[model samples]
Target chain A: MSGDHHGSSAISERVRHVEALLEARGLVDEGEIDRRIDEFLAGGSPANGARITARAWVDPGFRDRLLADANAAIREVGLSMAGGLQEQRLKVVANTEDEHNVVVCTLCSCYPIALLGPSPAWYKSEAYRSRVVRDPRGVLEEFGLELPAATRISVWDASAESRYLVVSRRPEGTDGMSEEELAGLVTRKGLIGTAAV
Target chain B: MPDRFAPGDAVRTSTADPTWHTRLPRYARGAVGRVVELAGHHPLADDRARGLPGTTQAVYHVRFAAADLFGDGDHAVTVELWEDYLEPADPSGGTP
Candidate 1:
């Protein structure tokens, strides 16, 4: 872990050096990088994903669209996975009575940042990446999610062009809740499939 | 190019260990899996990483049993892989 700290700072230093060079050459205007970062940060948050999930729970049609075509479905709520040069493909997997779904990027932390905000440190750590694909039940148990032995577990590795999102099953006794209130129950971990709503 | 494999087809990942960048992880290499879905065509990440003039290829969502990769689990692991990284699996190749 200590090495990670040093490694990160070294990377940051290198990035700063490159940024300074770009700014000095007038290739990039000063403060443009910060503005872009701010723009992305303003649009990225867990709330975005929560709102989408809440709509899916309350509107069956929206849920169907989300499951069928996530990239287009997100635009219904004025959201997009288009921060980069090209839009990233999104695949929404829903949890059902017979199965559970979880997402991971073993090579690197390729997450749905526009919807889920930044990934948690644990998600990017070597322990979770290496072990989850191998021992999912054990890892989920450590996360306090104890599933029945018969329940199937699906570990999605986002190693290619597509990203993944897990829609946790709606909890019981919440039919009276409104869409906004339902969104309140969603969490980053829940969207990531590490925890239930 | 047309999709070389379709959903429900059995495929095996390439075991080649290239020094260049690749999206294929080591654990899934040489593993037999079933194609679950077509993830559409996209530029190959390995060639793109190296700044090569890569062409678009079909990407498939392949599902592999955890027991096949790790030797002791009932769960499944799915990965989106480019067509170039996979080949038709031998019919006699036992369940991974």
Candidate 2:
């Protein structure tokens, strides 16, 4: 987090301004309803989704299914994300080798709430959101991750309809590691394209 | 021209919220762009917080060169943005 309270307040004020824009536009049916479905399900808890995703990392078949269809993969983890919206086309992309993956909705905070938890504070920042889309290499450098020139960097811009998850590479020498240990390596920022663990 | 904001327009960063919504990304504030295009608007943060079907005004994709955003990069990168996410650009606006 930045050491500047003013910086944080600026973000809050911007959020407030947007809310006012929404209200003035008569955009919502009510104040409590959630625009993003899974955001509502977590009820102030963000990491719940990440916990589910981390467990599936070690399960080979589960990982396969996840790579195949993230929506069902998450339902297996008890996500109501599949709640009624049958056409939920979610994709789980993994980062392996020297290559890495990061998700951004350069448009909005369009994260895969059904799988990963609420985006890390930095993930939603213009510092991240803009730089990741604009200067992904520079942003990744901040995380101490510099992709080899040979490695391919794929940034998935998640939208309200499309969500993405970075199935982080199980760090080197992690064989025989339990699911708990694996989870330790799956930081929220890693999922969003900032860090690996 | 309903007084709606666009992706490339100049917009100010927020410092507070009574509706308790998620905050906008930081690097975007005060940046300028052309009205690349308009994305749809969704229910606001307060509605999302209330468990109602909510959405936000996701604007257009304002294209920014990587050098402009990252400062030292010579690479090229593009940005897609929302309306409220931006306002209009400053004629002499510099980085914050």
Candidate 3:
């Protein structure tokens, strides 16, 4: 199935060729590219999303606001989806006991990069993308999540203009935990609905 | 901009030309689904991809039954699709 390594290597070479051409023509500079990389690296992480989810878990009003308008709601928490010059709208889906929610980019790796930082390699992998949509439960099991037979899964496919975030259900016995403690339990996988919180 | 379809509307995805760059997934074309959420208006990606003058189009989170999309499964696949790629499903059964 993995056709030829040379084919992919050719793609890399062509990409390098385009980059070199652009640089040679003064259309782009390595410093500008590095600065952009640094900006993206410093922009956001799963921790930011965890904090937002934690705040929502503790505050019902914020949860309502988040479900209503996610972009504005994140701004209310002092987090803005800026940088990368890409579309920034985000839609959050909450997991319930009867219905579980997961996110995938079936077309490509369209994710909430401004909220959860760069997506992990597994998320962008072809295996994850193709299998997750067809067999969500099976895929979740691979991620070590075995849902009850009665539970229904809802898979959200993100696209260019919009992104999705899965708000994992607050774990049991965490009622006494503070927002920071709760945030610590919100993994990137949990936010993506691969693993539970 | 006002949304063409509401959250609960039964709509069918249009089997539009897929030769060019489009956000509409190939698997979703001509499939019937219900609008789960109105994702607001945004620039039509189909237009943006072709380097044409872009205009806003209402987007919706359409939910398809797992069985409808992949034979059988205890799940639903919700995808964000633009307005132009969807048409109102007929009450008689088939997508017009």
Measured by lDDT, the strongest candidate is: 1
lDDT of 1 by residue, A15-107 (tens): 899999999999999999998778876778899899988989999999999999999999999999898668989999988889999999998
TM-score of each: 0.93, 0.54, 0.92
Candidate 2 residue spans exceeding 4 A from truth? A1-46, A82-88, B1-96
Could you tell me the TM-score of candidate 2? 0.54
Tell me the spans in candidate 3 whose CA falls farther than 4 Å from its real position.
A1-8
Stronger candidate by TM-score (1 vs 3): 1
What level of docking quality does candidate 1 show? high
In angstroms, the error of model 2 at B52 is 20
Tens-place lDDT digits, model 3, residues A1-197: 12222337877798788888888999998667667778877867999889989999999999999988888898888887666686478898889899999998877787887678888988888788888989999999999999999999999988557788888999999989999999999999998999886
Question: Per-residue CA lDDT of candidate 2, range A1-197, in tens?
Answer: 23322357877897778877887788855453455554444542335445555666667788888777666776676664553345445666777775566777765566765456555666667567655766677778988987777655656565334456677776778878787766766767766656765
Candidate number achieving the greatest DockQ relative to the actual structure: 1
Q: Give the DockQ-based CAPRI class for model 3.
A: medium
Native interface contact recovery, all models: 0.96, 0.09, 0.77
* Local accuracy of candidate 3 as per-residue lDDT tens digits, B7-78: 888888887766778888877778888988888788899888899887898989999887777678878999
List model 2 lDDT by residue over B1-96, tens digit each. 353764445433333333444434344444444443443454454457578786555544354433444565443332344344555556345535
Interface Cα root-mean-square deviation for all models: 0.6, 5.1, 1.1
Whichever of 1 and 2 has more TM-score, that candidate is 1
